[model samples]
Target: MTSYPMHTVDTAPAEARTPLTVLRETFGFVPGAAAVMANSPVLLNTFFSAFGHFRGGTFTPAERQVLLLSNAVANASEWAVAFHTLEALADGVAPEVVDAVRRGARPGDPRMAALSGLTVAFIEKRGHLGEADVKAFTAAGFGEGQLFEVVAGVAISAMANYTANVAGPPLEPAVEPHAWTAGTGAGA
Candidate 1:
């Protein structure tokens, strides 16, 4: 069977919408991705909006691109890694930077390298972090606030990553070309 139910928008089943409505409306059709997330659309919406906020406010356009795309690559999320990495490149991050992030490397930023390293550790350790990890991050110039931002980044991507895996949402029109290959280490 097809991964997602394919029907005319008007023909889809009625699903509950708790704030994912804005997203459903934004897309003009509710794919299984959103419908499944409707169980806790607030979680998904919060994740999406938070990512938007961070993209706009916390990190520089280039830095945000690096943190995000690299994280997605680390998680091996093909869909997210593809889109954000491209968005990063389109937003003026160097091709070399994009290339680095796509390969799940540190993109040559000490701060991002520290953050990404912590992120990989936290994920691999399932959140059991060492004092040295936090200290190393701070020593590298990431403050408590940066740590918070990193957590937010991880949370938001965790939502998208899980949703994408479960719903297997077809890549959005804007991101199809950047789609990830299965078992790739981009999101690992």
Candidate 2:
């Protein structure tokens, strides 16, 4: 197993310190994933930069969380599952919806279900969606451009999922209550 270092603002490499500080400020404490990622300045910066772009895109916070949660579930990332569950609810995704995602089921709300379903399929298909795949997403009221945005969201979340799963970051205190374990539905 790869052992990843969890760095804080003071301990992170020089290029990563500023972002670690920002993460500490934003989350009141830097998340374990960010802390582990801080060991690599390029990874830390690139992930956050992409995350920022994804956030600035058209998806609402709840929708964004849905995409993230779906990615976490698909990737079998327990840490991200816990974190995104909290973020989903904070962003106004219903408890049931988040729970459903954690359980690897599609969310109940039609729109959120569509979003989550599409995200899962995108990962499962490795981004090569057929016309029918595009139709299902668009029929759910997402624009064609938003399909591309969903890909962006998937990419952003996938990084966290892959990192946390590989590096095994300890859960942050705030996320302890929502801690998750990957089930049979998750990937390797």
Query: Which regions of candidate 2 deviate over 4 angstroms?
Result: 184-188
* Candidate 2 minimal-lDDT segment of 10 residues: 179-188
lDDT of 2: 0.86
**Model 2, 117: alpha-carbon shift in Å?**
0.7
Candidate 1 accuracy as TM-score: 0.70
What is the C-alpha lDDT profile of model 1 across 1-188, one tens digit per residue? 22644333344334434345555575554544455555554654676577667766556677666666766766776666766765787778777667666765665767767766777666667778899888878888767777777777777777766666665656666566666664543421
Tell me the whole-model lDDT of each prediction, alpha carbons only.
Answer: 0.64, 0.86
Error of 1 at 112 (Å): 2.8
Root-mean-square deviation (CA) per prediction: 4.3, 2.6
Model 2: per-residue Cα lDDT over 73-133, one tens digit each: 8998988988888788889999888878888887778888889989999999998888887
